[model samples]
Target: MGKLTRRADFLAANGGFRAPTPGFVLLVRPRGDDDPAMRLGLTVSKKVGGAVVRNRMKRRFRELARLVLPEAGIAGADHVLIGRQGGIERPFEQLAADLRRAIAKVRK
Candidate 1:
């Protein structure tokens, strides 16, 4: 899997970009008045599943972000991906598409 190394680098410096009730674990931060390269954080709640499941979900999110972030061109925003219980059953391709759409919206 590719690495989210650049996104991680950005997040270490920027704080967080937050929105409410994002659909899946691979979406991007919403549009805002910010100017830093986008970074991503992954959050998997315990209520979603057990520790193993949570960890797996987080890994999936991170990996997806790594693959998609470069094309996202979302500069100057902090992004966080929260994993929902539904994500465990959702298809990865759809999740990736959702992420791209989110990034496109936020870039506008």
Candidate 2:
């Protein structure tokens, strides 16, 4: 898996499929090319809280991505995980499960 670094990549994924879970929103889009890796982006909006809270949510989302993406992610796709208000307080295992479900949903 790789990181989705460019603004265009994020916007493209946002324009694709969206799956909303309790912890976050998952966006996915195919690259439409030969790249075999799945790319990931994270977004934690300021409306969720202040910088500290937003960063904490991002940290949690990053860890969840690392745990779930390798086995569950779709190849040649860009994925963006958008943090929600309850993300910081959600249990790690639950968050992971949410991501798993979100990936499945987006792929379908």
Candidate 3:
């Protein structure tokens, strides 16, 4: 999966399908013109914690994205993972499972 670097891309995904998981909220939107690659964005809001905590959560989210997206992510779509408080403390395996489930839900 490619990294979503543009602000507009994130905004577009925010307006798309949403699937809430125990560890995070997943947002997905189709790439209008058939770009075969899937893009990923991560959001760890200040409401979740202080800078240090938020960064940690982002790191975890990045890892999860790398591990899960290549195999399960939809082509021609953008996915944004919004981190919740639970993401910081959740087990890695469970977080990965949550992501897989969320992806499946959003695709439906």
- Across 40-97, the per-residue lDDT of candidate 3 in tens digits comes to 8999899999999999998999998889999998889998999987788899999999
TM per model?
A: 0.67, 0.95, 0.94
Question: Largest TM-score belongs to which candidate?
Answer: 2
Ranking by lDDT: 3, 2, 1
- lDDT (Cα atoms) of all candidates against the true structure: 0.63, 0.89, 0.90
Across 32-82, the per-residue lDDT of candidate 1 in tens digits comes to 655465656666778899999998888888778788877774665556677
Error of 3 at 25 (Å): 0.3
103 Cα displacement, candidate 2 (Å): 1.0
- What is the Cα-based TM-score of model 1? 0.67
Runs in model 1 lying further than 4 Å from the true structure:
1-36
Clashes of each: 3, 0, 0
Query: Order of all candidates by TM-score, from best down to worst?
Result: 2, 3, 1
Return the TM-score for candidate 2, rounded to 2 decimals: 0.95
Clashes of 3: 0
Error of 3 at 99 (Å): 0.5
